[model samples]
Target: MIYADDSGHPASGLVLYGWIEFSPDHWAPVLKSWLDLRKRLWRDYGIPVTQELHATQFVNGRGRISQRIPPRFIHRGVEYWKDFGREVAVQCLETLRSTEGLTVGAVWRRRSPAELAQTKSEAYSALIRRFEDELAEADSLALVFMDGDGSDSSYRKSHRSLKLAQRRVIEDAIHLDSRSSQLIQMADLVAWCANSSVDRHPGNHFASEWYSTFLAERDPCRSPREI
Candidate 1:
């Protein structure tokens, strides 16, 4: 199965859409580790388990995390937590690496004015092509779970087209809330690291190093393909 997510603004430098796949044997153990991490985050760090670990939110110290810090230390604390979140994400990716049947695939496109004026077809195309390539290489059928609630008509339309074309490789593209899956959250981190690496964002201290971790475990569709 594959859990997918996207990072970066379409109007910005580069938008990355990617997925991480796990074989049946490795899925359960990785999931258990993720679940255990979630529990520890709640118990040790006092982060609520339900607060989704989106890379941007954690890095920027927005959302529920703001409530957890004192105003005087908010600025410095956010920076620390941002690094901490990066560490957590790195650990999550490493956990996936410790298993077999794990694959990471992504597609990225630099957004132009014209592309931004329309739908995010390029982003969808990047993910679809990489996913198809991986499935063909593995010669296995799988289902895709993407981060969304099926609310975006444009995305739905693109997904339909992609699915129709690659029915032999993919079983379905199911829209889901990103908050609900740890695997999807890891995909979010991968995309986030890709974006930070491309843009050289100031807050991206760990992205460069973490990228090597990605390469170490990346599958056949190894690196993020440029569109």
Candidate 2:
């Protein structure tokens, strides 16, 4: 199974779509590890286990989404919280690295300010094609679960239009709300970090090397494939 998510704007230097692949045999342990991490995050950081870990918001200290910041911080002090948020994001990425039985993959396409509106659609389509090729080479089949509650016609069209002789991707992506799906949240983190490695957000101090720092070991490809 695959859990996917996307990050970056078409007008940005690159638009990224990425996924974490897991086999049936390792699914149980993968879920177990994430749940365990959530439990620890809640116990140690006052972060609610049920909270959706949106990487960008969480890193920049925007949402105050944590159920409560630990009392020691003196009313969630701005400078302190800002730095703490980066710590939490790093820890989350570390969890992804320590967990086994998952492989990360992403495809990104660069677009300039004048690019068409469909740039992201084209990049996502490229990702689907890569997934199909990987599955075919392995002689396996897989299902894609992406972060969203509503249907995406563009993604649906990508799968429907695949040119492979034997389509190994089951169908159009099975959409899931990231709020309720731990794996999709992880995918969100993966895509966000991967994009940051390529295009540093002005305010994101940790963006420059996070993909290389935390996720490189788990991702044999080491970096996103630029299409």
Candidate 3:
């Protein structure tokens, strides 16, 4: 099932992560149509990148709404950020929807920790629990995608505890039927794109908090190469 999430961090406050879900078979066409419209909006308005087009700035003259992205954009954005996860949900959804035989399901993530003692791994466990609770009805395949910590030494060190927590959660969850469950690290792909600025405008800023928390959750002891 397709799942997505976003992160946000404003100043000194704790990091926040948001998530949402979609039924891929049911929503794929709708999402594709919406993305087509987004592309056209960019083409029509000369907006080269998704990030440059702010949700508030997109307008629909036919609908007579000002400062509102088209209904589809609004709908998808709202769905993706149902719990404040961040923009990565959008990216993740877009990527997964492109494949066949995939369906999206409930999305979730831990937002912030009141104490530094709460590791990133622990926060991830909370996220997984939320997902499990939400999707208890179906025994469908589940794939979790998280943006990894960036390539900064200090940030990596800061995230050590969180990383350990994530590892623990994976270990705990691994006992489930291996054929039905899989966990992947999409951080490398994310990091490569972000660092290279391939899609800089649509970079992780839309879900900055998720990105920051990812940084804060790094396995401090692991090298960037290892991550």
Top candidate when judged by lDDT against the true structure: 2
Expressed as tens digits, the lDDT of each residue in 135-201 for candidate 3 is: 4545443444343333223223333334443332222221222112122212222232222121223
Candidate 1 error regions (>4 Å): 66-80, 117-119, 162-166, 169-172, 219-222
For model 1, what is the alpha-carbon lDDT of residue 118? 49
Evaluate model 3: give its lDDT.
Answer: 0.32
How many pairs collide in each candidate, listed in order?
0, 0, 19
What ordering of candidates by lDDT runs from best to worst?
Answer: 2, 1, 3
Q: Candidate 3: lDDT of 78?
A: 55
Residue 3 lDDT in model 2? 93
Compared to the true structure, candidate 2 yields what TM-score? 0.92
Question: Model 2 off-target regions past 4 Å?
Answer: 75-79, 114-116, 163-165
- Cα RMSDs, all models: 3.8, 2.0, 15.0
Tell me which of candidates 1 and 3 scores higher on lDDT.
Answer: 1
lDDT of 1 by residue, 167-219 (tens): 54454468777887777887777677666655565566557556556543574
Q: Can you rank all candidates by TM-score, best first? A: 2, 1, 3
